[model samples]
Target: MDFALSQEQQMMQRLMRDICSDYGLEYWREKDEAKEFPHEIWDDLTEAGFTGLTIPEKYGGEGLGMEEIVAVGLALGRHGGGVSGPNMLTLGPVFGGISLTEHGNEDQKERWLPEIVDGAIVSLGLTEPDAGLDTAGIKTTAEKDGDEYVLNGTKIWTTGAHVSDYIVTLARTSPMEEGSRHQGISLFVVPSDADGITTNKIDKLSMRCLGSCEVVFDDVRVSEANLLGDEDSGFYHVLGTLNTERIIWSAIPLSAGELALDLAVDYAKEREAFERPIGKNQGVQFPLAESKMELETAKLMIYKAASLYDSGEDCSMEANAAKFIAARAGSNACDRAIQVHGGMGFADEYHVERLYRDVRLARVAPVSDELVKSFVSTNVLDLPRSY
Candidate 1:
């Protein structure tokens, strides 16, 4: 019931903000223009032990909870420069949540968990060219051949694929049943340099600076040791993992909206229009007011869901709602920011354009707003499934 950050959490947020401040908006804009990943900032994060905020301390991580993770992520988004700053820490937990903590064997955890905590990038490759959101429809297959499994398929939107050493991917090991598409899917830890494995970098509308790509698997082979969970049960495992991903993805918008609102507020106070400060105008004031209200609530929703998840509760509905609310608020904030800035918002030099585009992905990536409404309607309201 109490919704407040503890002193320690506040301190953590301050530390994150300080680190992020070192990399200013101009630093991010320069990287964005070149379409390059922030390696130096990433090194600082890794060195600061922020990358593994949720992993166990035994594995050289910070051994924290989802609240701490959210704090760090929010700080990165609001102050750590931009959305790309938080992207560095997203993949490892994304892979670890499903493959290591939930399903990996002791040996697997020892090997992968430490590396992930140490800031070794580990991406999740689930979305395929044909799968879209229908993950069970994946045609990527991994067949058992003695001690090895041969994989052949292409994965689209494989974020961090270009630089990551390993990615836990989903593929089919057994043939699907006559009518059941969800069955027969399995997960594997695939090396980026495995034979016949190649990546095609993608140019996207936004979040392009985050470094996602299309990874093609052409008869890439891996040892049986790479398998995650039981072979046929990978589909279920992926679903559970996705729930966590949805929660984190949802918070991204909250952070973005907060940052956008802050920038807009600053611009409104300083920018003069019609011989008066824009902040004095009702048009600018109302939208900023609305965005501020939305941002606070969105942040609370994100934190509530994150806290619920750390307690091992079913948070699917809350997570979806968080994503939905945060994305809308973030997008709205960016739009208001554009209106507030008048012309400067459109230019990359101002950086509101970047935040605007980045926030759009929260609505589309992982889940659409329409789909989230469908879920809430059916699950929470006892309505029939619309989709």
Candidate 2:
């Protein structure tokens, strides 16, 4: 099987790399420190058409697929934006936009898809304060009221909510039936400025520029026309998008690991220890070498998952495996880079500290590593369900 990127993929990578170069590590550092969104970078990417790689051509997007999106995500992450840069592309276009493209009706798609292609921020409101990863456990309710639905609930970790023009929220439309906790949930395209909807920004250790928030919907009104996909089938619709998310999440950490490895290697070459460069010492060399090997291995899984997704094959196993492997590899690589840098690594000047903070999220968010293990054990191994 051919593993090399095609000419078009290579061009996409180069374009993203060049755009990222204009912003650079210093730009990310400033944005992170200020707890501000990368508006300039966002505008640049949207203007250049990188934000809508997965969107269809009819929607004013590039009409690319998972493989192309993966290429852009890797280049953006590797160039020092950490998870923040790639997230901007994925959360809006790949995650929320893809959901709408697949499930949204003609009117919904006509109204929203073009906006997404033009760089509209679409936040996801799936994780509730109590639900966490158990999406079916969400307490948010959307009760039908004539031509509109009245929503009431709170969603935490709603990324980009403060700046989002629209939030693709999941709420319970009917009571859970026996033996099916996933049923009765539905998706809604709630306008961020809807009445009775309140958003409070959440402070966090990493990805500060992305602006995670707690969104409270107190009798918020949404028209029936805003419902996405079939009623009570939101769980299945979300599941479909999640497979794609896992692949992109895997790429985030994989690229971060690449950046960490690059920093460690460059430092090892220049920093002297015991009258010789650190590269001469096996103590330093081995960890970096191991990280490189792990990253390379994880990257193969990422490509496999993306390819399977693009080919319309069953990629749940590969997607989960890629995320599980890449998260650890990326986190380990960043940790090793910190050790290699000694005291300087702890300081933000070297930028390894930021990478450390950003890559660590891969192990937790979207899906935890432990959960991925459980999924693989049960789903792929034909073992009994654990949770």
Candidate 3:
């Protein structure tokens, strides 16, 4: 099996590196300190055509595959952390393109995907106040009218909701099936200003500059044309879309792990302790060595997952395993980086502190650590599924 980047893939990585080179940890740290999103950098990425790298070319996108997509995200994350790359780019593809690419009529694609590629923001509405990882439990419902659906319910932990102009929201369209819990669930596109929508900011533990909103939909109206896929099949389709999401998440953390390792190694060479460079000490040298090993392992797993996804293979187990391993390695890498930097690491002025906080966010959402374990145990080992 060939395991090499094509000329085009290398070129995309070079382009992303050039763009991300200008937005270092200091720029991200300053944005985090202000609790504000980086629209200036956002504009730059938009201008670069990197924002909609996954959206179809017919809709004014580059139509790049997962290999190129991961390459772009990883290069950015290797410098700017998650938000500056995957966290910022993946939402548009996952939510904006989930329906548009798979089910959108020509008009829908014409109406939305081009703008999304051109930097019009889009986001998803799946995780609700009550629905964490149990997407089937989503209480949000869109009742059908003659040509429009009146939507009402609440969604929580919605990232980029405030800035996005459109949302692919999952809602209950039919009453629950007698035996199946996932049935009767549907997805729809809702305009951000659809009359009855309201958002309140949810204070976050980290990625503070990345906005998550608790949104309430009060009788919002949407046309029937906005339905994402066949009514009552959205749950399956949404889950399908997330396989890519997991890869993107997995790939992103690997990049962050690289950044963490880079920070630790560079710091060790320059910082002095006991009249010698910290690089000479085993305490310093060992952790960095182990971190290098772990980061490389995690990266291989991420690529394995991404390649399987690109080949249209069954990648659930690989994706879950990659995300689990990569996130832990990313956490370990940042922690080790911070430890290597000593007091300077804790001080945001030195930058490792920001990586520490951002790296922690890799664990909590998308799929929680416990849930990923459950997925592997049940799906891969052929054990019983856990509730």
Candidate 4:
């Protein structure tokens, strides 16, 4: 298959890189240090027409596909935004916009899609304190009361929820049936500012600018109109979006790894040791070379997954593999970059430490590496399913 980016895709990548370059590494470091949202950069992205990359043209979006989305995400990561920049896009335009575009009814689309394009941040609330990755095990309940649904549950790791305008939440609306754990789940677009909804920001080690949060819905009420897609079918709807998210998340590591490798290489070439540049030594050169190779290999998988998704093909295996490989490669690259820089790498000024913290999250959230391997074992290799 042809893996080369088309002219349009190349242009999109260049545009994203240019925009992201305007906000240098120092800006990212400051935001991370203060645990503040990159509101200025976010506004620039919205104004540059990136927040609407996946939404339909009828809703004031560019009507692009997953490939362009991945391109923009990678550019952000490579240009020093790391996971923070991509996370904002994913939480809002990519995840929220894609969910609404695919599942929302015409009225729902008209109501929410434009707002996202206009830079209304929307957070996803799926992982509860108990459920974790077992989405089927969530205890969040949305009980129907007359014409409204009252939601009660606590969602942990609700990224961007504190500042978001709305949250696309998944909750159990009915009793679980025998042997059907995935059923009874439903999705909703609950207003973040609604009464009874409270958000407490989580102090995180990485991706601090995104404001990962614990969002509590204590009898939070929403009209029937807020329901997204069919009740009891939310799990399937969420699965439909998972492949896209995996591909986007994979870009996090791909870009971060590339950036880290670049930094290490530049440092190696200039930093002198023993009366010569350290890069001349095989010890410094070997790890950077290995990281470059691994990062490039992972990048191909990311592009392949994105292509499959854009072409309307099933890509669960490819997407999962890409996420796993990319996360590992990116984290490893950052670790090695720190090693190459020695003591300076540990310092915040060099920025490798921040990238290291941010890249490490990819292996856990979005989906764990072990879970991805389990999926491959059961689904791809035709092995027995291991619970």
Candidate 5:
């Protein structure tokens, strides 16, 4: 039950903090305003080896695990990069690097891992038009055609497709088995520039820098070699990826919330009302204090899940709990910070507005807070399936 970070983990945290300091809040602010990806900051992180924390050393990565990645993400969020900073790692390192190393055979790893370490962006094409979080209900099909598979489908909320060189796509390779919707699903490493693949950016409320998109695949053909994991077993394999994602994702909003609170506290100390600073008022102090405690609690859970995952343990419950609690804690912290700042919180110059928008998206994305509760009710409480 050692809670302290190892020496290497601390160094990685310091490196991420230094990198974010180099970029500064204004860098993220300008990128968010322009709806452009922060290529410079990402390149810096890649050069520093933070981008490949989850990748194996043999593949030109740091050969670390979930615990180290969580630390890096938290540092990114706390040091002023917000969601976009941590998201760069998510696109390639967590999604591409982890997936390939865990499921892909030797040839697949030899081919993709080095490319990911070299800073290739990999977007996830999972959510379809008909299937939101219901991954098993995806309508996209990949029909076997001799030695190739012809893919035809529509994927919505495919984040970073515009900048991604590859998209880890999920498709139905065979008809559903009776009473088992999870069967027949398969994962593929689809090339972003393949013919018949059209990606149109979807304007969103928050985290605009990375961008989410609607991608259409009409008869996009991929070689059999691109298939990830055992055929019809992707549903099972992806479960591990999802758990890893949830665990590490806890840091993004958690970091954003901490940054927002810091801004609010700084403003409260200097902003005087009736000849006294607002920090003296209990009305202002209580909510900020509560947010601090809540965020602290969520941080512990996040690290617990990450450690368990790194140890090859089942962290499904811990991962969901961490994400659920962290999202609520982070979003609530941002809201309170806005209230504490009064009208200035609405202005982007203060940065709380952007933090609020970006952190709030965690409640519904990757997996909704509602679904997280549903998972607890069933898996943790031994209740019947609600959906």
Candidate 6:
């Protein structure tokens, strides 16, 4: 398969890179330090038309596919966004735009799709205190009452909820069956300011600029029209978005690794040790070389998975594998970048530390590497399910 970028794709990359460069590493560093979202940069992205890359053209979007979004993710990561890069677009465009387009009824699409393209921030409410990786075990419930649904439960790690205009939430509509926990779940578009909804921010290890929080739903009500797809079929709908999310999340860290490696290489060539460039030493040279190879290899799988997803193929295995490999490779590259920078790596001014801290979240989030391995073990290797 031809892996080379077409002229259009190259232009997209250049556009994203230029926009991100305007913000630079220092802009990100200050945002992270203050634990503030990068609103200016996000506005820049929206104004530049990057935020609507995945939305359908009819809804004032660019009508792009997963491959194009993946390219945007890579460019954002490589420039200055690090972990927060993909979050800027993913919440609104992917969660709100793609979910509505793929599964929402005509009314739902007409109501939300254009809003997403118009720069409405949409946070996701899927992970719960008890249902981090075990989506089937979620305790959140949405009960039908007349013409509305009353949602009651808690969602943990609801990223960007404080600033988001709306939240795409998943909740159980019925009790779990003995043999099937995936049933009875449903998706809804919840207004963040719905009467009974409350959100409290959570301070985490990284991606401080993008807040993750605990969102409580105490009889939060929404009209029947808020449901995205057929009742009891939200899990299936979520499956479609999850794979796309995996592919883009893989690109974020994968390109963050590229940025880290580039910075380390530049540092190595200039930093002197023992009367010679430290990069001349085998210790530094070997790890950086290994990181380059790993990052390059992961990049290939990331785009391959994206391509498969855009073609409407079953890419669960490939997407999971890409996320697993890219997260590990990206984290390893940041670790090596830190090692190469030596003392400066721990310092924030050099930037590798920030990249390392931020990209490290990829190893555990958007789906953990362990869960990915289990997915591959059962589906790809024909092995028994371990978990």
lDDT of 4 by residue, 109-147 (tens): 999999999999988898988889989999999999999
How high is each candidate's TM-score?
Answer: 0.96, 0.98, 0.97, 0.98, 0.99, 0.98
Lowest lDDT 10-residue stretch of candidate 1: 80-89
- Looking at model 1, residue 365 earns an lDDT score of 76
Instruction: Mark the 10 consecutive residues where model 5 has the least summed lDDT.
Output: 81-90
Candidate 3 local distance difference test against the native:
0.82
Whole-model lDDT, candidate 6? 0.89
lDDT by residue for model 6 over 112-209, one digit each (tens)?
88888878899889999977889889999999999999999999998899999999999999899998789999999999999999899998889999
RMSD of each: 1.4, 1.0, 1.4, 1.0, 0.9, 1.0
Instruction: Give the Cα-based TM-score of candidate 1 against the true structure.
Output: 0.96
* Candidate 2 similarity to native, TM-score: 0.98
Q: Estimate candidate 2's alpha-carbon lDDT, on a 0 to 1 scale.
A: 0.90
Q: List the residue pairs that clash in candidate 4.
A: none
* Stretches > 4 Å off in candidate 4: none
Give the lDDT of residue 108 in candidate 5: 98
lDDT of 1 by residue, 110-200 (tens): 8888887777887889998887877888999998999999999999988888988798989999998887788899988887788889998
List the lowest-lDDT window of 10 residues for candidate 6. Answer: 83-92
**What is the lDDT of every predicted structure here?**
0.82, 0.90, 0.82, 0.90, 0.91, 0.89
Q: What tens digits encode model 3's per-residue C-alpha lDDT throughout 1-387?
A: 677778988898888888878887788888888878778777888898887787888788888766777777888888675534567876676567645787677888888888888787887888987778999888898898899999999999888888789888999988876678899898888889889999888887677777889989999999998887789988987876777788788876777778878988998999987999999999899999998899888878888887887777888988888888988888888899989988888998777787778778778768889999988788788898888
| Regions of candidate 2 where Cα sits further than 4 Å from its true position | none
Quote the positional error of residue 61 for candidate 6 in Å: 0.7
